[model samples]
Every structure is written in structure tokens, then in C-alpha cells.
Target chain A: MAQRPTKETKQSSAREERPPVVREKAPALAPQRGRPTLILVGADKGGVGKTTIARVLLDYLAANNVLTRAFDTETPRGTLYRFHPDQTSVVDLTSTSDQMKIIDTLATAQVRVSVVDVRAGGLEPALQALQDTGFLDAVAEGEVGFILFHVLGSSIASLDEIAEVAPYVDDADYFLVKNHVNDTTFFEWDPVTHRKYFEKVETAGEITIPKLNELSYEQVEIAGAPFSTFVANRTAEGGPADHSFVLRGYVRTWQNRIADEFDRIRLLDRIAGREGA
Target chain B: MSRRTLVFVACSPHPRSGVSTTARLLTDFYLSRLADVEGFDTDPHAPRYHELFPDRTQVIDIAAIRGQISLFDRLLVDDGVPKIVDVWQRSYDRFFKTVKEIGFVEEAHLRGVEPIVLFHVDPSETALASAQSLSASWRDLPMVVVQNEGAAPLGAYAHETLGHYPSTRRFVIGPLDGAVAKTLEQPDVSLSRLLVAPPPEMSIVIRAALKAWIAPIFTQFHSFELRRRLEGAQFLK
Candidate 1:
């Protein structure tokens, strides 16, 4: 009505209206720079507790006030979304638009960390997608921080993944996670083969997710709550639940163990763009 | 009153320290009191506990996941039935390891299940050490020191700061007479049933002696359970 405003003027006026990004007060040990972080949790095989690892990472990031968002690759019915419904979305990582939705927003998203839970058999495809989009190039250029968590199962194929995925993580943080959520035994992996893939990469880190009790694990699944929530003995909606104290303690202690590994890797520091600090 | 399930785990690292005897008597005592009770002999291979109460007791080998679910899943359920486990020393480490891993005792407390460890105090240094070690690991777990009248006295090991824990009370189980003990040792035998109505053929003197033998033990069991109920009682102020 009042002299038709130009697009540029309106955009500038709108940008002026928005408040400045108030960076969350990181802990004294956290890095000074608060750059965006991208973490990929993937496994070539199904049921390696990839989603479980991603959920814990989200919790760890959240605990450190990292301001994290997650994309569960378990499309249609995201297992990660179920536990962390408020901060997650289900997406097809290989789809063009979906890829853009994830990769495009990292530069501008309010969240400091973005976690992508790669679906079964999607690790290579997801990596290739990142390569095609030159996302790895951006990460290498130090525009943003990136991490690839290769969730390993018990099979020989899991070892083969180290060879396939190891090449791409040269510019990003690479973690080889041996998920024992299913209590898998790696009798197939001899020390020589283990050394060939793991030892060769000086930057690569190994994390062993210890075996939790069968009943406790099953109960948590049945409760359909995040590990932290389960440990608190609360329902998904934060309602009262009659969960066992012993079971909750088991989860809490186990989560602490897993969190210790993340801490040892300086995960928060890497996400905050502090390599040596 | 919320029907609390008492899960008494009669255990020892040393063998034949009267673990099964304690378990059997406790199970029998619950049955005698007309309380709903279930028994589990952790060793399926040699399920001697279940042999006494075949219909009521189950042989559960918790080494496998399936067995663990069968036992632990039910323990958390509000069945209003107390459970007594005749734990084998051979499988003691594995059994407790799994229990501690699963957080069974804590869970049991939430579900109104009281899990008490009845450590069979015997002569071996290993047994004494394990009693101290186990009580330390399971600090929140209710413990009772069982002194088998047939076994050696714990001496310094029974001291509060050393072998025996602070909260635990002492129980003297047996120095049973040969003929009387033989009668109770028979398969499917229940001391409670015998005490209530001894067999017609059983001599009055033998019956009286059997009742007398079990008197202090049963009193200790009742008193220990009452004290625990008073301690861990969620409802009663």
C-alpha cells in the first residue's frame, strides 16, 4: 500500500528485524569458536546399533549445550526420531532434495551440530552423495567440522567398510565404533586385519560399546525412551513410570562409559572447532 | 498392603556350605506360612532345589538370554509370590555377574520385590572373602549371614567390619540329627508340613526334636524378613 517495497529492501529490513545469534555459553573447556558440525553414523549392515550410537551422540551434544539436530535415515518410521522426536526428522539421505535439505542448511541452521543416522546399506551411498555435493571439500577447507562414525558389526564385511569409508575421512574425524548392543562377538576379525585398517589411519579412533544386560536393553526398547530418559525412569512424555531403579542405574552407568569414549575423542572440542585446545 | 515378593538368593563361593539347605527351608517356611512362593534352582544340570518341590519350583539356567528373561522378567512382575533361589557356588560368579549387570536388585526394589542374599558362612577363606566382596559390590542389597551349625564358626571373619556386613543379621541353620535330617532330606520333603502334621508313624520324640531343631532357624528367618520389611517398606510409615 505505502509505495511498493523492493525485494532487496524487504529482505534487508527482515534481516534487520532478527536478533543476533546468541551463542550458548559453552563450558570452560569447550572451544572458543562455535562453528557448525556434521556427524554421520552409518553401518553397511543392519542391526549394528547405529541408531543407538547416534541417539547417544545427540544426548552427549545436548548435555554439553551444543545445540544439535538429527536426521534419521530410517525413512518413513525413523527409529532415531522415535527416541528424540523433538529434535529429529526422517529423511532419505540419497535423495537430491533431501540431501540439499541436510547439506544446504548446515551453514545457516541454528543448531551447532547436525547428526545423520545412516540407514543400513546406505553408508557408501551417503558418502558418495556428500562427495558429489562437494560437502567433503567444504569440510576439508575448514569451513565446518565433520565426523564419520562407522558403526561396526561382528562380520568380516564390517572390516571391509573400514577400507571403503577410511578414504573419505582424511579431512574429517573418523571413529570406528564396535557396537555391542546385540552382544556380537568379533571372532572373525584377527589382529592382522584389524591392524591393517585401523592402525594405518593415525587419526582413526576405536570405541567399544560394552554389552548391556539383555533384560535391561529389552526394557528400554519397550519403554521407547531415550537412554537418558530411560535412566531417569521416565516415559517419553516425561510422565511417571515404574521402571526398575537397577535397570535405570545400569543404563546410566553404561551411558557414562559411552560418554567417556566420546570425551576421550574430544568430540565436543572437534564440533566446537577446537582441535588442539 | 502391597504384596512384596521376597527373592532370597542362598549363595556361597564354597560348595556344600548349606546353600540349598537354606533355600529349601526358606521356601518351605513361606509355604508353611501359607504365603505364595516360587523356587528356582539356578543350576539346571543339577537342580536339586527343584527336586524337593518339583511342581512349584523351576530349574533356571540364566547363562543363556532366554533363561535370564524367563527368570528376571518374572521377578519384576507383581506376582505376590516370594522367590527363593538355590544358587550353586560353581555358577555363583556368573549368576551374580548377570544380576548386577541387569540391575536386578534395584529393579526388584521398585517392583516391591525384596532380594536378600543369604551368604552361607563356612570355614574356607574363599567363602569368607566372597561374602565381604559380594556385600561390597551389592551395597544396597539386603544381606544375611547364615551360620550352618554343621560348619566352622567364622571367628574373626564374622566381625562387623570384616567378614559380615553392618546391616546383616546372623542365622544358625543346622546341626541336624542323623535320623531326623535323613527324613527331611528325602525328595519333596517340607519341614513346615512335617512340623504342622508329622507322619503318624513318626515317633513323638523325633517329631518334637525336628520341630525344636527348626525353631531358632525359622525364628531368625521371620525376624530377618520382618526387620527388612520395616527397613525397605515403601508404604508403611
Candidate 2:
């Protein structure tokens, strides 16, 4: 268990530096307090509304009177920055490294609400490193981690993938986030078909996240910088005009439905312990 | 001798790029404060979100991830050193059950040396801890405790359980960015190595407004069955 001589040898030779390892939890503001709330927005495929959903949740927490922050494992182009400025968010231009630092910062302080957006395939590796580092155990000991999966029409294929990765999510509070609903017929999988798809994941011993829908053109534009700036404005352009017709008229209705359910999952209530709503 | 490879783990919906989006962000954030940080996106090969960002980050694609361990092993062997990794977890518990307890153990055995495990506490420990508690199987893994405040006891417990491992470490940060960090007087181990950095300036209001306006889009996709699907993600069909 002594420090390896090889590491010393390598350092001695080139003076090259490895990224500093973050094994212990970061220091906190104070000690005798509660842990922060950590929420993860994930989906196997791109365009499944992972970033969008995470943004909405963070916005809700901020608007609804909570100290909230957003983390994007995906870099430079943080979804929050598409709309808000740097001061408005801990938007890391570097993505994963920034995310780890922010998490370390938050874990040290134990911020109340922290929303995370994972890029399509990065979840496994990032989680692997965190586990190796032991921050996962630290976070587990302090906060509640919610896994949010955005599904549209319950693509059976996507669900099958979700099942394979389900074991990785075994310990967290899982929520299926149905996103970008252009129509509302409420999905119903044929029991037989559903069961068969699940078998694939089980047999493979891994989650096979089903395919998902990406945001529409209007959504993309809305999530883009120029338009996001308009939305971020304070006056007419900032107020309502900033948002696109699609986002204002349709997107809100769609996103609210899921948000309401989260409100219902009563995670906050559970955190507060029945004393508050 | 082969140095253990570095592996990053987390929940589903991984970014397409190879390097971690979160790790890239933190590195940029810190490096940016001092100087420019180059980023590269290697999705097709690494396929992780962090890899997809700017060219400043050296994004590894799927191909890179496929051989990430061996690659690191070779690099470390050539360097004559044990592999050092900066692991990032979006949440605590998810990490505890998977990487720290399971993967780390394996990596240690494979590399013939202790693999460095770094945990990022992104503003919450309750949910993370709850998840670990639910998974209870990895109760005995060495973990470096992270918290805002009053999280020392929890950290101490974890430390006592796994602190015996030579690879274990701990730290705390806050009281500046509207955060709190607490511990019982002094940790059982020497608190000399704790890494406390200045809190990043992040706003809650802007984030909230963003969510409210965007909620409908995400909310519209929910339903009783969808909830069931989410809960039963383990048994998806």
C-alpha cells in the first residue's frame, strides 16, 4: 500500500503530470448539515431530451425557490449556456472535468439541488471512474440521486437497452421521463413484445438503451445560442418573444406534464419530511 | 508490469464522445481560470458527450474507450508509474455500488497496483447515499468522503469502513458559494491532505427560470405507464 515507486520513477524522468486524482469528497461549507440533491438526466441515444429535461428541472428548482445548479457532462456547449450566461450557471466550458470539479465543489458544500446531463455513451465510463474514486459512495452517503430517462412513445427497442443498464441504476430512484410529445396517446406496449425485448438485455447482461427522438428543428433553434440569448433577455425579447412559438405554445405544455409528475414523485416532500409541500 | 487502466462509470444515456463531458468541463473550468485548455471530441470512437464539445479537449472516441485500459497501461508502463485516474460521478451512491466497490477491486487485481479513485460530489449526498444504502452490497469499499457541511460523520463512517485501503483519501469545500461543510471535530485520519478549492460562482435563479419555461416540453412526455417503464427500466421489454 506504499506509494508506488513506478509513479515516482515516471515523475522523476519526464516531470509529466497526470490529472490530479479526486478520491475523497471535497470539503463542505459546514459539517453538521444535510447532503445536496443530485439529479441525473440520461438516455442512450442522442436527442432523447436529456439536456432539455435537465435544463427544465434546474430551471424549475431555481424558479420554485430552491438553490439549484446545473452540470453538463457534455462540454463547452452546455444546455444552460444556450439560454443563460456564465454567471447564471456553473456552465463548464470543458464539460466532464468541469462537471467533476463542480460535483466536488457541491459535494464539499452539499448543495441542495444539482442537475447533471450525461452525453449518450459517457455515463458508463464516468460512473466507472467515480466508483473507482469513491465519490459515488460519498454522494450516496449524503444525497438522493435520481436517474431521469427521456422516452418518447416508449420505443420498445430503447426500453430494451434501458433494461440492460437497469442494474447499473439498481440503487438510485429511477424516473422515466417521457419527453417531446407531439401527440398524447399515452404509450402501451404489447405485453408479449415488451417481455421479449427485455429478454435481450437480460441475456446480454447489459442494458440496451432503446432509440429516442431528438428535438425538432424549432427546438434546436430555441436551444441554440442566438435564440437562447433572446430568451435570456429582460424586456419584450427576453420575456415572451425570446421563446419560439413552438417552445412557448407546445414545448411548455409537454414539459410541464412531466415536471408535474416529478413534483408528484414527492422527492422534495420526502427530503423535507412531510413538514413542507 | 501492467498498470491498471482507467475506467469512468455512471448511469445511462452516455455522451457519444470518449472522454467524460463532466471531466472535460471541470478541467476547462480550472484551467481556464489560469490559461487556455484545449478540448477534443472523439465520439464515434469514444462516443461520450464530453468528447463531443470543443477541440480543446482531447476527446477519445469509442475506439479509444475500447482500448482505454490497455492504452493507459502502456502509457503508465512506459512512464514507469501506476495509473492515476480522476473519476467523476454525477451522484455518490451510483458510484459506490459500481466503480469503487466493484470495478476498483477488479482494476487493482488486474494492474498489480492500487488504482486511484476520485469522486466528484455534485451538490448532493442524500440521494447518492440512499442509492448506496439501497445497494448495501458494497458497504465495505474504501471511499473518500465529500460533503457540504455536517457530512463528516457520514464521511467518517465510510472512511472507517474503507479507510484502511492505501488508496483512500478525503476532502471538503464550501461556505463561499452558499454551501456548508461540516465534520465531527477532526476526522479519525489526518485531515492534512484535504483539497478545498474556491466555490464556482453559480446562480440558482437563472437555472430556475430556464426550467419553468422548458418544463412543458419535458413534462409533456410523462404518463402513468412511462413512470412504470422508468421504474421497471430493469425489466424493459
Tens digits of lDDT, candidate 1, A1-277 = 1122343443354245644323243222123245678999998988898998998888788778878889999888999999999999899986899998898888777776899999999998898778667787777667777898989887778767766665566678888898887878665357876666556554547788887877778888999988888877689999988776556666777888898999888887787787592
What tier of docking accuracy does candidate 2 attain?
incorrect
- lDDT per model vs. reference: 0.78, 0.40
Q: What 10-residue stretch in candidate 1 chain A is worst by lDDT?
A: A23-32
Minimal lDDT window, size 10, model 2 chain A: A204-213
Clashes of each: 0, 162
**TM-score on alpha carbons, each prediction:** 0.77, 0.38
Error of 1 at A62 (Å): 5.1
Give per-residue lDDT, candidate 2, residue A265.
68
Q: Score the docking of each candidate (DockQ).
A: 0.19, 0.01
Give the runs in model 1 whose Cα sits over 4 Å from its true position.
A1-33, A43-49, A59-67, A74-86, A131-134, A153-160, A181-189, A212-256, A274-277, B1-6, B54-56, B74-82, B109-113, B151-168, B225-237
